[model samples]
Target: MARKIIKTNPNLIELIGNLKDKSYNEEVAIWKDVASRLEKSTRRRTEINLSDINRVSEEEQTIIVPGKVLANGNLDHKVTVAALNFSKTAQEKIEEAGGEGISISEIIEKNPKGSNIKIVE
Candidate 1:
């Protein structure tokens, strides 16, 4: 038998609910995809580095991490990054590079239709 895991973080629970709701209302799969990724166990969740994001993305793009963003390398161009969480230094570096590091929920609220967004994980 498998044990049921309950998410205790109210914010996270709310975010997931909002994602699913938005997906249903907008008929967009991206929000559902992001929500599912976020529902995974902590160990199975994504932990992406700055270098990977930079390599997989282009300038002025909107990207989703579906997990945590780490400050492992450097970013040269400006972009908008939305993730479940971000390391302190990662957020700082993003701002320094003229980029914006925002939360997944915020992104969802900003772009309800989920247009032109790339998943970086």
Candidate 2:
């Protein structure tokens, strides 16, 4: 059977351009990697709730997501979360929890080796 083609979001494209302009190479690489995965239909589609993020321990390095991160769950840990898209509530919650809600580009810049990165959904 042939696989379905997934289209990249325009918003994501613009965001990537901005990251690149800012010289965030790691984030650009990560975004490109995720885009490729989506195109191939090999990337898992998971909906990450806010509660799930909240439950993560502080020891966890970073939470990466290929899809959007919702704000339905609570976050209590002070870990970093990197995703393609983050809802406004989710962003606020993450910040309120003392954690950083960042884009995949930001995470890539911080960890160029791509070590300790987790795909949340």
Candidate 3:
């Protein structure tokens, strides 16, 4: 019998590998959890919206979206958003509202300890 492996995007594979490595080195549970979620297929992956971020996040929070972020609503306060992908409009909206849109790997490199980070899927 052979074990089946889930097929995933190349980018996601790299990202997941990095996340697992980071988790081992840093021993943080969040990184591992995020990687697990990201391992899912594109269809099942997270798809977060700006409105959801605005509703659930607080000022100066660092939020992670495991999937692409859609631009649908307004953001009242500035928050750091880390995601796999972001729509052009969503990126603009985030930047316009004094927030920053960064990739997951970028955020991981910046915050190895994963402090003050919230996964908003």
Question: Best candidate per TM-score, number?
Answer: 1
Evaluated at residue 52, the lDDT of candidate 3 is: 96
The global C-alpha lDDT for each of the candidates, from Candidate 1 onward, is: 0.93, 0.68, 0.93
Candidates' TM-scores?
0.96, 0.67, 0.93
Q: Report per-prediction Cα RMSD to one decimal.
A: 0.9, 4.8, 2.1
- Model 2 RMSD in Å is 4.8
lDDT for position 24 in model 1: 98
Residue-by-residue lDDT tens digits, candidate 3, 30-52: 99999988877667888888999
lDDT of 2 by residue, 1-121 (tens): 9666644777755654554544454443554555544344435555688887666545546888766789996875687888877899888988888888887767757776577666665
State the lDDT of candidate 1 residue by residue for 3-95, as single tens digits: 776788899999999999999999999999999988888888999999999898899999999999999999999989999889999999999
Q: What TM-score should be assigned to candidate 1?
A: 0.96
The ten-residue window of minimal lDDT in model 2 covers 33-42
TM-score result, candidate 3: 0.93
lDDT of 3: 0.93
User: Candidate 2: where is the Cα deviation over 4 Å?
Assistant: 3-37, 40-44
